[model samples]
Target: MDNNCLFCRIVAGEIPATVVHETDTTLAFRDIDPKAPVHVLVIPKEHHADVVTLAQNDPAGSADLLAACAVVAETEGLLMEGFRLLFNTGAYAGQEVFHVHAHVLGGEPLGPMLAPR
Candidate 1:
């Protein structure tokens, strides 16, 4: 785990977080800033700058991350209602935290993928 990474800290129990689900390899927690009624952040316990890095460096962990997201969706009762999974990779993508994580959003109509263009 990267000492400076926020998610790593959360996983390590160094930082406080509203953890909703956890497994041997993954951690799912409520987002501090919620975009929807259900906004959970799923992440691997291990450190990875982004999803691409996680996929390239630890494929199994990457898969675990995805699995964790699914578990969170089902547990949160958003599976049948539908939910959106998002990964912000870099600065332009609004990835404020460098640690790789997936945002599971649901609980209401999310509208378009982006604002009117």
Candidate 2:
């Protein structure tokens, strides 16, 4: 775990978070800033700078992260209605936190994945 990473701190119990689901390799928590009615962040316990890093270095953990997202969606009652999973890789993509995580969003129409250019 990266000592300076916020998500790592949350996973290590150093920081407080509203955790919704947890497993041996993953954690699902409510977003502090909710973008949707059912917005949650799913992350791997191990540190990875971004999705690409996680996918290349720890594929199993990456899979666990995705699995956790699905579980979070189901638990948050957004499964059947569907949900969007998003990973922001860098500043241009709006990734404030360096630690890799997926945002599970639903509970209402999400409109579009991107705005008009």
Candidate 3:
């Protein structure tokens, strides 16, 4: 775990978060800043700078993350209904947080492109 990372702190229980789901490989929590009504972040226990690094360094972790994302979506009532999953890889992609996390967003129809931050 990255000691300086916020998501790592959340995974370690060193920080408090409104957790919606958790498993052996991942943790799902409400986003502090929500874009949608049901915005949540699903992160792996393992520390990864970003999705690219994760996919390169650990294929198992990548698979686990994808599975966890599916689980998070299902648990949040977004599966089958409709939901948007996002993983910002770098600064250009709006990755403010370095930790690898899949953003699960739903509860409303997302019709257009999201504004760049």
User: Candidate 1 overall Cα lDDT vs. reference?
Assistant: 0.93
lDDT of 3 by residue, 21-112 (tens): 88888888999989999999998889999998999999998898888888888877887779999999899999998999999899899766
lDDT of 2 by residue, 43-112 (tens): 9898899999999999888888888888888888997888899999999999999999999999999999
RMSD to true structure for each model, in Å = 0.9, 0.8, 2.2
Candidate 1 — worst ten consecutive residues by lDDT sum? Answer: 108-117
Candidate 3 yields a Cα-based lDDT of 0.89
TM-score (C-alpha, index-matched) for candidate 3? 0.92
Which candidate wins on lDDT?
A: 1
Expressed as tens digits, the lDDT of each residue in 10-104 for candidate 1 is 99999999989999999999999999999999998888899999999999998899999999999999988799999999999999999999999
Error of 2 at 105 (Å): 0.6
Candidate 2 lDDT at 89 equals: 99
Tell me the lDDT of model 1 at 111: 86
TM-score to native of every candidate shown: 0.96, 0.96, 0.92
How much is the lDDT of residue 101 in candidate 3? 93
